[model samples]
Target chain A: MIQVKELLAILIASSLVSNVVLSQFLGLCPFLGVSKKIKTAAGMGGAVVFVITLSSAVAGCIYQYLLVPMNMEYMQTIVFILVIAALVQFVEMFLKKFVDSLYKALGVYLPLITTNCAVLGVALTNVQKEYGILAGTVNGFATALGFCIAIIILAGIREKTEYNDFPEAVKGMPMVLITAGLMAIAFCGFAVLN
Target chain B: MSKSLERLYNGLVKENPTLVLMLGMCPTLAVTTSAYNGLGMGLTTTAVLAMSNMIISMLRKVIPDKIRIPSFIVIIATFVTLMQLLLQAYMPDLYKSLGIYIPLIVVNCIILGRAEAYAYKNPVIPSLFDGIGMGLGFTVSLTLIGIVREFIGGCSFFGNELGWFAPVGIFKMAPGAFFVLALLCAIQNKIKIEGAKKGKDVSKIQSGCNSDCANCAIDCEKRIDDIEITQEDIDSTAKINAAAIEKELAAKGGEK
Candidate 1:
């Protein structure tokens, strides 16, 4: 019953029109904190994309197969969080064991991903929108891609502006925030696509 | 002041989670579209924070250090779910407005950060007050930001329109949150600069990763030592580098 056109629309809408960081404000912490260098930003973004997409698929299956049948939908919050924490741990171990290079790049960020609201936000949003498993997984990927795009852009901007002279009050984080506001305004222009 | 009162003071002013320490920016930015929404989110977080802090403090002795982070998360998520159900039953409007944010509270850095920094190490009463203090500080900042945004963006105060100039309309949207917070942080910096000029020891008024606990992403404890070493010997580059190398070895000594 779902059309390819509809899926494309979902993908575009989630990624560009309603970006996770710029518009929805889901993952502002990582967007701000780990974005000092483009290399690290891209690494963090890659880790997020991997974790969110996989976790969404897993969370969707668990919800649809287990929670719904039991009529314990209210327990979604706790269940999803525990699942995410465990999943992050599992992903960390897997990466460390199988791909040591990637583990080196993403080791520190892996632990922090457990507390990143975007992961939990995507899961809860999937439930709220009543998407099927496939749709939910796609939405999760799109949302995380949106986050990746925003963080890379911000990191690029920050690196360029690192040495620019500014007033004392507007030197550090305040400047970054102001830049984010302007970026949000720019992203707001994408609403026309909706 | 008593130890509990000092903890309260610390959470409120010395190390406020939002403005000062800059933890939990997601809810602060997303839910502060209006004063009422800000108050609701802040109070809900307050409830979760206080109760979880108390419980975590009680169980600090039992929870193994290796698994303490997961244990803290489970405790926080339980309270958040309970709050969600209570809000859904009694305050449906706030519940709807908050939506995904309610459940998202589990991953909020403030609760977990406080658990790691204070609750796990402190006693029950001080931890409880620390939670209440941080909660109130968060509530105050959110409400302040909400009032400012609502006043400008809506041309109204707390949903009551004042026949003033037309609303900017942007203040109510996503970008408005960033601009307002940016402006507030700038103002805070301006005050800190003025205080430093007057020789009031304004060293603690830092931005970004300079905070004691910073955000959940950056481990400020490790960075703090680096900061101290650099400040002590800016000219002795070779010495500082050697010291940093030594510290890195020390830190990684226990690991495989």
Candidate 2:
């Protein structure tokens, strides 16, 4: 059983120290692809937070109730993936019907989240660490927040650099990568908290 | 060259999943803290890729069109789980080091991309070779990145200490991964430019950006059309568009 204080530490640790995108290296596809503007980056982050938190809780329950009880712990990967995929589809439908504005903002991202490794990574991490439903959901939320933070910062940097003159060789992708590297260095400072 | 050999050469050089195509950046950056870890991750992903490609190709006709994506995910997850179990049983050290990344391989875009692009339409044998080619390409690039990071960051070669010079410890960390990759990419871009200047067939080796900024539709003041376009630029853009059209036609032909 994780204490409330330990949960707080996990929230901080997962968000800052071991960031999902910068440190853990999950979800680089969207991190790089959707980070051109701060608005889109924040939108992507919000969608991720919603999806990951819900999926983590759902995946936790399914693993606990379905996989473990059946003594097929080895099937968690397949089960979690299918569950997450189904959950994303359902969430997309739910948002489209009930929350039209949110659906517009997040709908494009929900489909992409299916292939995002961060969601699956957190689900598997929860299982490996043996976190219960509550703890798993909190960790998932924190990890998504970390992804949001990292991408927003990268977007801000990219926006600022959009006008700057760069060397021909370091023009586009390399420049973005180097900026991400510096951000990673800044985030590495959080490791001292541990 | 035979079609299979062409695929092998294409993957190994022309369209490397990691270096050129930039498909699987997650594992490329995370598990490359050391050369050995990179090699292990690369080889493991290769096994999964090859198997998944073969199986998916064999079952292409049986799978329905509307539900192909989920079907691909299920097949990939099954293979990924099998590989995870085997690694856990035999290579616990690597298993521990790689950690969540093993299962995360199911989400690697390169695998799904190939399944959707090549294996779904091609014959079984060529699809199998395509997987191996792409897998080898990914492995080679990863091992190269690993060697560079490990050598610079750890002052070691595959975990053996050299103690010859002071190590740039940053290279071993998260930031170092990005820096090394950026440097490598910049060097690659420089080589491509140099090759283009020499009038070699550098158009075949386009960057991930593809250098066709006009059609990208980004509303930037520095867009390619806003700037003075060169003869070489037009030629390369034409080549890229032609190749793209050829690919689209082939895909349509396959559907029929």
- Give DockQ per model, in order: 0.63, 0.42
Off-target runs (Cα >4 Å) in candidate 1 are: B209-215, B218-256
Over 4 Å off in model 2, which ranges? B195-256
Candidate 2 lDDT tens digits, A93-149 = 999999999998887668767657889999999999999998999999999999999
- Measured by C-alpha RMSD in angstroms, how accurate is candidate 1? 6.2
Which whole-number lDDT from 0 to 100 does residue A176 have in model 1? 91
Docking class of 2: acceptable
* Docking level for model 1: medium
* Candidate 1 residue-wise lDDT, B137-223, digit = tens: 999988888998898899888889896899999999999999998987898799898998898977666554333232355443243
Q: Give lDDT per model, in order.
A: 0.86, 0.85
The 10-residue segment of model 2 chain B with minimum total lDDT is B212-221
**Ten contiguous residues with the weakest lDDT in model 1 chain A:** A106-115
Supply the TM-score for candidate 1. 0.89
